[model samples]
Target: MIKSGETNSRSFPGITISTDLVITGGGLSGVCCAITAARQGMKVVLVQDRPVLGGNSSSEVRLWILGATSHMGNNNRWAREGGLVDEILVENTWRNPEGNPVIFDMVLLDKVKKEPNITLLLNTAVYAVEKKDAATIRSLKAFCSQNQKEYILTAPLFCDASGDGVVGFLSGAAFRMGAESRDEFDEKFAPSATYGELLGHTLYFYSKDTGKPVTFIPPEFALKDITKIPRFKTFNAKDFGCRLWWVEYGGRLDTVHDTEEIKWELWKVIYGVWDYIKNSGNFPEADTLTLEWVGAIPGKRESRRFEGDYIMRQQDIIEQRTHEDAVAFGGWSVDLHPADGVFSEKPGCNQWHSKGIYQVPYRSLYSRNISNLFLAGRIISASHVAFASTRVMATAAYVSQAVGVAAAICKEERLLPADIIHEGYIGALQQRLLKTGQYIPGLVLEDKQDLVQLATIAASSELVLTGFPGKPLLKPLTLSVAQMLPLPEGAVAPVVFHAEATADTTLQLELRISSKPGNYTPDVTLATRTIPLHPGRNCITLQFDAVLEKAGYAFITFIKNPLVALHFTEKRVTGILSVFNSVNKAVSNYGKQTPPEDIGMEAFEFWCPQRRPEGHNIDLKYQQGIRLFQAESIRNGTDRPAGQPNAWVADWNDPQPALTLTWQQPQLISYIDLVMDTDFDHPMESVLMSHPESVMPFCIRHYRIKDAAGNVLAEKRNNYQTHNRLEFATPVTTDTLIIEVEHPSEQVPAALFAVRCY
Candidate 1:
């Protein structure tokens, strides 16, 4: 624990709050710093120049989060970050409803707001840093536009997450920019010598079709033959011209010295080129299509990288080298833009380093000279050549996550970023990462027993009812049956699965999976399917002739089929109305009453066969009526009055109801996997579904889970945040199960598509 005096020292504003550490920049790296520090119970003040979170990927830039994690291997770094980052992903799933950027802003804002230890000052710029001596920074001053005020921050530790390593430069910490000569780092891919010029920036844009088609007109500065460039084959106009070659660095003048001029000229070229393409008869189909996106600001790739304890080089990446302190993974090939401008005949190009993936040492991501600070993201300590490969957002995200964990440890140990890295904290970092759901295929564990156990063991909560042992298999087994059965309404039948032997070395085992439920004794109405299962590894999918619903119940029990798992628990899960409490209220927004016209209910009905409010002392009817009345108010986008309390107007309400009727014994409780029908909030492109505890790191560390009987079933500690769909391997045995949500004190109730439990 930190000394009481130190806590008091950093609490006051304008007092130059001193701490064990300070992180500058609110981008991915800075965000990770605050999250990691907060998890370790450290007080951190995250300063960002913009009003919003997520620098380049934010709606401010409107760039998609590009990375291997978003593409495949749900086990990407975000899964391991497991706290705020995960929350953002979950929220994205909700807001986007379609896995888009609509909810991205909210996700970023929510992450910063939910942390008590993190004081996020938005719309603020760090002007300069105060140095006590040559090595230590005494205070940092920031200008806050909202308050028209200035705040000076002080801390023992500081991280340069500004992408440009602003704090490091200001503090006199050794750093480098541009590509280093091959001989400097002995990296084969590096240029012979280093220069100031580095990879340029890009302005990303996105557009959608309105009811009417829009045409384009060329600007005066348009380049007539941009497409004539040699790299035209790889350039895809439809894909939004993301390839770097499309956005030429500099043709008329030096790009390094004239970035602003270059950016302005490029915009003109972009519009001009689009106009010509749209107007020309060569592409008649694209006439109706116009510029969907025009980036507000350009995304910069290379910048000043802070000097760290260890510098990762291009050789390390190509060799697929492993590090004892490996914290992040990089898979994207190394891409380098030529220093010289691209000519009309041949544009600049990049090369692929390797087909496989490699690990980035955590030591290279923190400051070498600065004792208190740690860095993550693109500004990590790496030569320009190596940064070219690691600069991708996905790789940056993983690096940021690792830094967050390391920063948290620094706070816990009351040490600087430099001290922590040298103290062998890498093992703890790896352990924390795995617990949070991050998949590092090449991650090596320090504990022999733990490493061996993790390698051989396979676990799935879905196998609880079937009695599958949570142990490794020495030899594969398989079982087969020749019976067939049909499935129940909105339900899949239980297939008594077994493990049988296999002769082929590669063929592990065969497990028979029934496609349907049997209604009568030996009613051979459905066909059985076989799936191969690999003991202690691999995802098993049971194939059948029937078109199975992932959202429907996976029957594993016999007495009465209960949902084994909530399939289709994708971004959106469908939910139904169930009432047991009275609720009613008038909803108003901005001190004005919102009419029903503002919010229209497509479906609302009370369906319960025999149950009534008076019977069972349930008051179901009264509760439902109240809920119905308030549901209408939400449609109008109004908030319920402060005095009104009985209504449970869940945000998961939909204009169109899917299933509604009386609750029965074998209740047809089918989920809809609700998705956002449209993007109502402009920037929120979509709402992401997130479990509140998972949205913020501190929530996970301090949260406790309880059963319906008020007994604490489990307490999850450690952060694992991501928005991927959570699949249950086993089904729930209860006839009816109610999921209770306990949100963090600082966070809002997370929006959800549906609550799915079969």
Candidate 2:
């Protein structure tokens, strides 16, 4: 018989750790919980399995953050999720213009380091959970790389934010994995019976655009009837090679259970597919193509889910059940992969809703058997069908945020997992979510005196502004009648602010000065020269010497009235900017072959749809205008030039970056024009904020910038490489303004792009 182990003092021999909450798994869910808990004045300890903070969405998986609000909506920003998610987006958009993975790691590290309330332990793995009693887990044993020793973390509350639900499994919390038969939960998507069958896995890779001849080949495992099995036809590579490849199998096989085995299959398929294309002569450019990424770590879509008080079933999602205890919402359809262990072209694999979003109750996130433990992410208690939809990372982030807040509430009230329902705390929890800037569709607000008071205070204290470069002034810059935003009450809110403000109202902002740290030279230094500021609305101007010998970027921060709006404008035609990522590795889009007459020129088109694309502007007044893609130089009129290759590249010289915009003049600065030029595609990266008038000249000192409605803007741009001049035309009236340039990239040169005010 296996006897229960005791937590001896020797377990935590040399650790000086302290925190009110300990969150495991630094993935989307874990990080969200950490950020939320830390913001609420709770000491937080966050642990992760990987070296980086983003788990499946990191370079490890190469998966982008997908959400319902992506590319559309008033907050059509890179990522609408706020707090930690927002922080990550801002860094990706500006600092890593090339979408460098290293930049993501650094950004996460910097944010965690800056927060005094957060204690981060990297390269750590949790091995065991020691509980003092059936209701409470006393400590957790973790192996750390830096110390090369084991340590125990003791906290009042614990969260299984790990996407794998490791803590729940180790703590003996009831959990389920794989598929459930259709009749089990009456889920239309469920299998005949809940079985251990799992979704197929993948190892995603990318190719650079290099104009060259390519040939296609057949796979060694080429089954003539492969498409008949439902997987082969998903990807359109007739020769079985050289395309967007996805090779998967039943992840439950023991012989193939090892991570290394899974990784091997992925690689084998990747090369096999390439070989087929090359041999078949179907992919002429495959010969010159470069692999930008091999298979990232195998991303397991569905796994063990911890059983909670209320299990989310397929019926809950299909019927769009509105639970009285709903704490979060998801709009994604019930997307389920084939269970037959092969890629299927079956028409009925995924499900979508026509109207309202699916609601997730609080009881579905915490363990019913464990009192002190709560779970989030894909592993939250849900039937197999439900897991398929909620498995996406964006949805996971919201769930994680909810977990963090609920944990805080549990600690403060000294309540058990079951007690939360009786206290009517779910509504309070929903309010906290709204305050954080995440949108939970169909959230019905319950009346709470304290919540109303807090919301009122937040609304009143917020700054609302108009025009770019809104800064403090020696006199009030009168707001033009056209520049004012429609306010509900007499109280105004800050429309767009630049910097993160401190308790004392100090603004902190970062500038991109150099690509590499060693580029620093004392002779060419940057010194801040501040301008005068007054009340109402004003602009602060900062002047510095642009004497850097090499190309790079820098950061700046200043105070301003919150009501003004500073629109950032860019005109880039052919290069990487802070905004966009190239679809392939080439600056220009080139197909392998074309008709004989159009031998060297490749035909392409560019469409912006409106004047200002969503997330391109903060005020939401302008949508992008459709423009045609015009090539300055081409080998031929309609075919790719013989030597011109297509590749995924990033250009940092584009006008758009993580720029903090404040109003310089309210009336004159009505609309902004952004233009760009790139070799392959146009990528623009910038942050847009809206706030009340009182919050002018968004503070830049504290490394935080928000819009008038408290929405935090975050962006991620991968299109890099290239050099081209871009232009931005923003109307301005007031004198003196603060413009903070934001650039996030590993290889940004000296300030080659500048702003010209007309």
Report clashes for each candidate as comma-separated counts.
Answer: 54, 174
Q: Looking at model 1, how many pairs of residues clash? A: 54
The TM-score that candidate 2 achieves is 0.56
Task: Give candidates' CA RMSD values in order.
Answer: 19.8, 20.7
Model 1: per-residue lDDT, tens digit, 10-115?
A: 4324535566556778875577667766766677888888878777667666555544332221111111223334445545644454434435777777877888
Which 10-residue window of candidate 1 scores lowest in summed lDDT? Answer: 615-624
For lDDT, the strongest prediction is 2
Per-residue error (Å), model 2, residue 278: 4.2
Across residues 575-631, which tens digit of lDDT does each residue of candidate 2 receive? 111221112111111111121331111122111111133112211111121111111
Runs in model 1 lying further than 4 Å from the true structure: 1-20, 70-87, 97-102, 145-147, 191-197, 213-237, 241-258, 290-292, 340-355, 432-758
Q: Per-residue lDDT for 430 in model 2?
A: 74
